[model samples]
Target: MNSNFDDFVKQNVELLDQHIDELFDSDSTLNTDLKMMMKYSIDAGGKRVRPLVLLAILKAFGKTPNYDILTVAAALEAVHTYSLIHDDLPAMDNDDLRRGRPTSHKKFGEAEAILAGDALLTVAFQWISSTNLKDRIKSELVLSLASDAGASGMIAGQLLDIQGNQRHYSLAELKHLHHLKTGKMLLFPAEAALIMKPSKLQVAELVKDFMANFGLAFQIHDDIIDVTESTAILGKTAGKDVDLNKNTYVNLLGLSGAKEELNQVLQKCEQDLTSLGELQPEMDLMILEGFLTYLK
Candidate 1:
């Protein structure tokens, strides 16, 4: 929410873009079409929120990255972008646009889009493997990434989400679903950061809570935006959930109720950050505040 946090995120985006270009080379040994598709989707505008938050949290803990943070961040962005590519497929959300342009499948054809996503997913681990951190730390990050982005996490949440269409979900059920589908990837930053720089147990717990609540708040904001924003403003199809008859916080809780829940989560997120008092807390708290504020 703060100007400082905004600057931090903006700077991180620049870093992420640079790293992606280097890591996902357009002139590599891969087929030209596949490379073009991959580059197109990756360069498609995204917030790079995951890596920024991860870097912020690590800085909060009075630690610098164990390796080139931008490269590591790019790895996560690859995963996130890959998810978007798959999500926009005709078999998935059937989206026609993303980041203000044609969806990968729409731009490159479905088969090429699919391969592009696959390449990005594989490249995520490849980037991680290429990192200079210790083997244990590298393994921890890779394993956490797999767990968060894989079947037991985002994939499972997506399955639950698809099945949840046409069915009513209690607030608890909705939270659980988003926790997996959206929260895990969002939480990955703080989780991976904690592993990189082992903070005190209490700090670790607070960080988990903060990231979890932030993740939920972020998703709720998205649900609200889908209902309230125009497709042009969203740079992606808006109200696709409604079109698909999918369950969402806005539908279940009503817009006001959803906003209320978001505030509660945000208050808790702020409180968690508050507990980390002093000891170079200003920058970290500012980043978190900016992260949350930017959501609105």
Candidate 2:
């Protein structure tokens, strides 16, 4: 990533932390234990990647970060964090660590962690609703987020992922599982930004295409990382997928093949981003393009 893109990411991460603190951490009305659990996971370190994606899309379309935009981004982070909390539950991946600390369940107990996840997920829409954006825009964002994070999207992908433990998946099946599981959330940022700022039909199509490929690349990178990185580096158990016999790109296509596929997907992402930049010549797409390099 270029210095400008790195700077943009740093600025947004700081802004997101402040916004999330205002929205959740500083709130005093909630029950003490539940609030503590939620805040613990929220404060748990993460790069705020989903929120950054939303902010990057906003910037790509020439929209400056505002109260409404930051709130929306924070809401997106809330949902992402909620997913992680739930994913670490005993019934799910049963992870004991996240973001270099104890997982929510381990730190707060299973029941509290579940409620915390639920609270964060529900409150995310509340955050969106409270935004100063127009009612229609708010509605669109809520609807998009709900669909993307709910049973039809991420949850469905998760179900398939668990089921993968029992069965072998072809490469196409694996891609489909992740497209719903991981792709939808990644795609949501671009979709939400376009909703906020209506672009030309051509530009909208290109943005969606760019995010679609970007999402795939991200998932492949994650699968590769799980095998190659350590628990300390990943902040989660390494090779857990292989241990659980979960289907992944590495298992199906081998490490080299998965890397090749990631490169191909990233190349497609670059092409889509290139077309989008040309279509909207006034916008600097460097930040959006910078995301691809991270996967590589």
- TM-scores, each model vs. reference: 0.94, 0.97
Indicate the residue-level lDDT of 44 in model 2: 88
With candidate 1 superimposed using the best TM-score fit, by how many Å does residue 261's alpha carbon deviate from the native?
1.0
Give the alpha carbon lDDT tens digit for every residue of 1-296 in model 2.
49998999888889888888887655667787877787788878897878898888888878889988989988888888899999889999999999899999898789889899999998899899998899999999999999999899999999999888789999899999999999999989988999899998999889889888888999999999999999999999899988877899988999999999999999899899778777778887899888887898
User: Can you write out model 1's per-residue Cα lDDT over 1-296, one digit (the tens) per residue?
Assistant: 35677677777777667777876574367677777787898888877788888888877766654445666777888899899999889988888999999999898899988989999899888888887888898899899999999999998888888778758788899899999999999999988888888877877888888899899999999998998999999999888877766789888888899889888888888787788664335435666667877666
Q: Model 1 misses residue 43 by how many Å?
A: 1.3
Q: How does residue 113 of candidate 1 score in lDDT?
A: 87
Clashing pairs in 2: none
- Tell me the TM-score of model 1: 0.94
What stretches of model 2 exceed 4 Å from their correct place?
Answer: none
Compared with the true structure, the alpha-carbon lDDT of candidate 2 equals: 0.89
